[model samples]
Target: MRFIYRLVFALSLTLGVSAQSFAQGLIRDAEAEIMMERYADPLIQAAGLNPDSVDLYLIGDMEFNAFVTGGQNIFMHTGAIVIADQPIEIKGVLAHEIGHIDGAHLARFGDASRGALATMAMTVGLGLAAALAGEGGAGAAIMASGSQFATLDMLRYTRAQEAAADQAAANYLEATGQSGRGLVATFERFRYQEVMSRQRQMEYFRSHPLSADRIGALRRSVDNSPYVDVTDTPEEVDELRRVQAKIIGFMVPPAQTFNRYPESDTSVPARYARSVAYFKRGDLDHARAELQTLMDEEPENPFFRELEGQMLYESGFIAESIAPYERAVELMPDSPLLRIGLATSLIAAGSTEQLESAKAHLRFALTEEPENSLGWYQLSIAHQALGEQALAELATAERAFSVGNNVEAYQFATRAHESLESGTPAWVRAAELKAVAQPSPDEIREWNRNQRQRQPLAPSRGLR
Candidate 1:
């Protein structure tokens, strides 16, 4: 249970189950995903892709990059989102990534990767062996040739993909009644990077390979489009500011955030950033004060109340945190994230009635977000506290399975089967998990690939 408690805390702070859970460098926050979907769904719809089939993930790294892997899954870096000044800018990036998906670029990349690796291995291997055998000049020449071949192949393919994506992104913008100006501006910002050596350029530039000609092509597209001069709605602009503030507050040092978002700026985004900065720095009094001011300004804002709850709950105010967490959930009943926060607070309170309430919240949250490992973990604790031993084991098994810990999942599922009656839903579910206790890597990959195809895109909590 103590480990469960820590897992919940880590989930809150890092938007991940554990450090190891993010081996793919993903940050699975409900808010971030929602923001991305809001920007992407329109492009996807315009591109005639099924929204349900396209899964979006936010990369944890600060580098500016976006790419689509095998399926319709799009990965965008948090740093890119944070750096963009408007939702439209991110929308542009999303549009380009979707272009790659629509064009089957990932499959092409896979094919190219196979051949490139083989070529590199043969030439580089020989080159290294030659050098190691005292043929330094011959080795250098051989290695250079191999490296050049691989690099040129990659650069050519990526450059072509980038050009195609740029054109496709512009078309999506035109079709969706959105401006390509954001896309043009975003790329223009990176135009200077073209002068740098490819190795010295940012990952985004390296992967997307930009050039003056590419910029000119994009500019021409933007200039010809009817929506070129259009700007983001007031609501969209406000959301972008708040999202950026939140990212900066959480990602940067507290002192730096406070300095950037000084008290003189009483705007919602400024206050939000300062509140999170205060919380992160253990300045509980300041954090609570800022959150209270925010709540006073917008009593119905679920995110404001959610932050208040997070600050209280994370600062060890378990009993007091419940009220705000509960309020946030009430305001946004459909938000699984808020529900999980409330459930964890209730569980931490450790009272019989609180445990019951916690279970209700956790069950509701899990119903909407079954893959949420933290939700499953907390639900298990709640079930155990309520003496639902069978259900508790099942929940623990689910949490383990969600986090890729098959051994723990298997053990817990087996124990769950012993307590539940035969043929019951809980018993049957446990049996299913028990059967796939040690899923092969390929099986996991296939299941993940299929799950994206099956699930509907969850609506992001609207910008407030």
Candidate 2:
């Protein structure tokens, strides 16, 4: 069944919170991307999907739900990471979402409703207007409204479509040599919670609408499958558990999290979680000790090593922070967050020799993840340190403007103007680019027109 996905915010609860508030922090994005490549990529490939073409996004919400937005993006709430039991469970969830994509569910829905199309158009229109006006809050509100509209549209999907996705997900799981049991297990977890008090039931269940028949169907599929190894290896399972614990440790109260999962050798994740709790509670000494102990136990684990560096950096031990970050980069060279951390610390330490390396690292990261505004900003800073003032200003202006960094953009533009020779071609081009970044009547009109062109046509209804 084709359906539009939507997210309904409690206005009273989120009135003052803008959508930008939901953007994944730099560190968080790095962690998420790593996990996606490690686990999600394989499952997506098994499902006969292109991993590179699919955009995975982290939604800054604590709800245990994930859904597709339009036909292009997969939005996963942070809560899903915290609650999932294993990497396969996450893979399972993503596989199901991919099932929707592979089944052309979004296109089917897009072809079904005019109202949804108009909603999408208006949503994009409002977003462009907000961007032009420098009203990030208003833009977020409109984007949220658009998601809600899509969800409502999806709620109308036929049982057959849902069943088809379920079956396809199971097939993909089998083909990938992963147990389809994770799907059943995930559904069972949500199903068990369905009987809880209204307030206790997560938004995942509210929208997913679990039924006895769904559970029955999953069980039947699992029972009929020939694969026997439904469980992950101890190491793989531990990583999943640790990832969840770390996320929850960061999000939930320290006392409550520790109380739920005490520190133990077998439960290294719980220890890590407690370490984070200590860090958050401002007990830096204890936090440092906890992380140090973990590092001693697992000297080669890149995640723990990275956490140690993070602890040091956050606690203001700038000089002491470089070693662990450097070690982590050696262990996981492709990690952008680790590179960002290393770059930031190098800049703070005023290491002129490392500036070029920092620039190279950030430039590489931008190539892989162009939407990372922070990388671009850091790249600009690196260029500045290298005495490339004009280049630095342009990169900074481009990044700051793309992500609504108006004040920074304006400042960079002014600096670029002063740095260039008065009558040269470079100076004129810099001024023009600066104008493009800044607010102006002509720019606003152009932005509006561009938005309209990008808007999707209304979906046709009554096609079930």
Candidate 3:
């Protein structure tokens, strides 16, 4: 679990969450990503999209919004996650966004201005602070003026397009044996948004432009569906609650988290939120206590281990943090972020044995997440500490390339190539980075068009 950011911090909630205080912006978590994959991949596949090709981004903003600007990308706000009462509700939203992707709404709606919202693509563990800090960050900005183009809700749709999406969402739900009741319920809850003043309206309704006819058509299809009685599974419900708790614990203020899940609420989700809230409040003792209680109840859960590891790592207990991070990787080996966290802790320790192990872990992690800027950053650090200057320089170039720093990437790649053994893998990669470092203006324009988005990829999950 991690957020895309400086590896010094940015561990994810219950998944090596960085201790960065919750703020409005963008983030990534493995747990959240897998959860989304489970929810979205099925719908995306049903919509004829390649599941692996599609991307899901978790927005840290509080606004209840989800959209597919174009292609296989879906942006979901944390507010939508917290606002949802169950997993199916969020799935409904995912299905709707998939509808947009299938319909190629961006192409039809003139997505020429779409490249304005730059993002941290090709990463799993991320919190692009430079991109998500509203109008100021380097991310998601209009290149000409760095305007908050998408932040202020720029992706409006025609009423007909929205209605088509509604019907298409219903079709996918029916095909997947999932109910649209949650979607209907979600929309109905905000049915009044249309009548509210634009200032008072939710971002979703404003962008979607809902009407009674649209709702009525969707309700009719849902009411007539055979799967209308279907609901979220127990596992889905549990995970959704945990995701909500963790997001609230991280994204919401500690005061608001305490208010929402107060002391009297001893439920796991409440405890989870409070644990994060306590952590955010600098009450490590209380935070550990709450987390320990959770660990005792579910000893097999890796998230507890990841959270503890993150806390210890950030607290400067570099040696102590290794055990839990190692255990987390052991439990969920497929999670690149957990491996990155373990590698990070090991790199910080700087032992010969630890650095070697960190190198191995990073090789595996970087393979799975080649675009993780922080992973490359950590790899660079590990290589430097291990006295592998050429490899370190190559890793630095990779990191620079991952973050779109073409000039720096080119310079470092050239330096690495000069020292690396010819015909080696490192040399080949350095050559590749240097090759694309100085793209033509048209190529740069095209690359940026395909890359701009709201956020990054998957990482460790289950904040509860």
lDDT of 2 by residue, 1-464 (tens): 11011122111011011213333211243454566667777767776777776767554456677766565567677777777777767877888888887887766654445456556545644553453345556655665563643534433445666677788888888887777777777888778775776457565655355677987897788667777367788877776677677766676677887787776443677787788788777797887888887889988877777777666776788878888888988888876666766777676666677787777777776665554555666777788888888878867775656555444565577688888889886577568756766655555555455545656464332111
Candidate 3 residues 298-409, lDDT tens each? 8888877888888788878899999999998999998888888899899999998999999899889878877777788888889999899999999989877776656567
Q: Tell me model 2's lDDT, rounded to 2 decimals.
A: 0.64
Error of 1 at 302 (Å): 0.4
- The candidate that achieves the highest TM-score relative to the unseen native structure: 3
Q: Write the per-residue lDDT of candidate 1 for residues 9-46, one digit (tens) a residue.
A: 22532342222232223345555656767778889988
Report the error of model 1 at residue 31, Å: 3.8
Residue runs of model 2 more than 4 Å from their true location after superposition: 1-32, 110-156, 192-201, 263-266, 385-387, 397-464
Error of 1 at 70 (Å): 2.7
Error (Å) of candidate 3 at residue 448 is: 19
Per-prediction TM-score to the true structure, in the order listed: 0.80, 0.74, 0.86
lDDT against the true structure, per candidate, is 0.73, 0.64, 0.75
Better of 2 and 3 by lDDT: 3
